[model samples]
Target: MKLIGSSTSPYVRKVRIVMAEKKLDYRFDEESPWTQDSKVSESNPLGKVPCLVMEGGEAVFDSRVIVEYLDTLSPVGKLIPSTGRERVEVKTWESLADGVIDAGVLARLEATWPDRKESERSQAWIDRQTGKIRLGLAAMSRGLGDKPYCSGIHMSLSDIAVGCALAWLAFRFPEIDWRTDYPNLARLHDKLMQRASFAETQPR
Candidate 1:
């Protein structure tokens, strides 16, 4: 199997963390979708990163889809509940965490054009995304409070998504000072990073 992704992508990091936790060995092909020569479009029509290609030419795109498939591959560390309301709750948290990454990625992509005129660049648009990120942090922090993991029991896809999104936000918007603003989130990231999977997947 080959996991195609970029180093700075939070979605990619989430899938990487899951594969590491599940102890699934696969080749990692780091490629930026933004590059003109990238093969992302070949595997996924959406042309996105974090495309997981299986041995038989089967491809799984989207971090959610890839990670969920990986969870079934090994029982070593299941990242999602197998059934019941708990499964829904875990998926809900995963959605929220993915939203955080979506907003950040939107803002970052717009900001990539530094040479654009002030009128061409919409600070308000960027603010809206950042605002979403801020709200997400507060929500996660409040919902998490004293729990070591987002699911309140064991580390799940929720933690992987939240941790990756938080780290990506910190990497892109250092001035946000999220570590100090949300101590709970800071602690969560700290604890997750203790695992080699997270530490190795940190965005550069």
Candidate 2:
């Protein structure tokens, strides 16, 4: 398998962390979708990063799909529950984390699109996305409370997703001090950072 993505993408980092945790081996093909010469579109129609090309030449795009499929390949460390409400809860946490990341990405694009004129950039759009990020963080903090992991005692995909989102925020938007506003989340992020999977895959 070959994992194609840039080191800076939080979604790509999430997939990488999962593969590391599962003890899976794959080639990392570093490519940025934003670049003019990028081949990301060949693997993913949407031209997104983290496109996984299997040995047989089959392509799996989307970070969520790739991680779930990778989890089924090996039982080294199951991140998502196989069935029942537990699965739903873990997936829900993942959704919240991804939502925050989605908002942040949109906001960043609005602020930094090179071709757009200052007059063309809408601060309202950026503000709206940032609003989503703030709300999503609050909800995540409430859901986490004092749990060692996002879902429970064991580390799930939820923790990985949340950690990636928080890390990305810190990387791209240092002005948003999530660590101070949510100490419990800060504690969780700190703990997650200690793991080799998280430490080695920190967003560039």
Candidate 3:
């Protein structure tokens, strides 16, 4: 199997972290969809990164799908719950984390346009995204409190999703100062990073 993506993408990093945590053996094909030479379009119709190519030429796109599939590979350290309300909770957290990344990515992409005038850009949209992030942080912090993980006592996909999103926000938008406002989130991130999987899969 092979994972195709860039090192800078948080989504790709999440999948990489899951792969490391599960000790899954797979080659990484470093390719950014933004690059003209990237083969991401061939692998995924959406032309997105973090596409997992199976040995049988099957391609799995989207970070969430890839990570969920990876989790099934190992029964020992399941990142996602198998059934019931527990599964919904994990998926909900993952959605929240992914929304953070989505907002950041959208803002970043809009800012990249050479013709984009600062005044012409929708400040309201940016503010709305920022608000979502802030709300997400507060909610997560409250839910996490002193817990070591997001869903429960043990680490799960929710932790990985939230951690990766937080890490990316810190990396690209340090001015946000999330650590200052959300101590529990900071603590969660600190504890999650102590794991070897997270350490090795940090975004470059």
**Number of the top TM-score candidate:** 2
Task: Rank the candidate models, highest TM-score first.
Answer: 2, 1, 3
lDDT tens per residue, model 2, 110-177: 99989889889999999999999999999999999988899999999999999999999999999999
Which parts of model 3 have CA positions greater than 4 angstroms off?
115-120
Q: Give the TM-score of each candidate.
A: 0.95, 0.99, 0.94
Model 1 ranges with Cα > 4 A deviation: 114-118
Per-candidate Cα lDDT values, in order, are 0.89, 0.96, 0.88
lDDT of 2 at 141: 96
* Models ranked on lDDT: 2, 1, 3
Q: How well does candidate 2 score on lDDT at residue 100? A: 98
The residue ranges of model 2 lying beyond 4 angstroms of the native Cα positions read none
Clashing pairs in 3: none
- Candidate that scores best on lDDT: 2
Across residues 1-204, which tens digit of lDDT does each residue of candidate 3 receive? 999999989999999999988889999999988876877899998999899999999999999999989999987688898999999999999998999889888777666655788777877777777777778777878878787788988999999999999999999888889899998898889888899988887776
Name the weakest run of 10 consecutive residues (lDDT summed) in model 3. Answer: 106-115
Instruction: Please report how far candidate 1 places residue 69 from its true position, in Å.
Output: 0.8
RMSD of each: 1.4, 0.6, 1.4
Clashing pairs in model 2, backbone N/Cα/C closer than 3 A: none
Q: Per model, state how many residue pairs clash.
A: 0, 0, 0
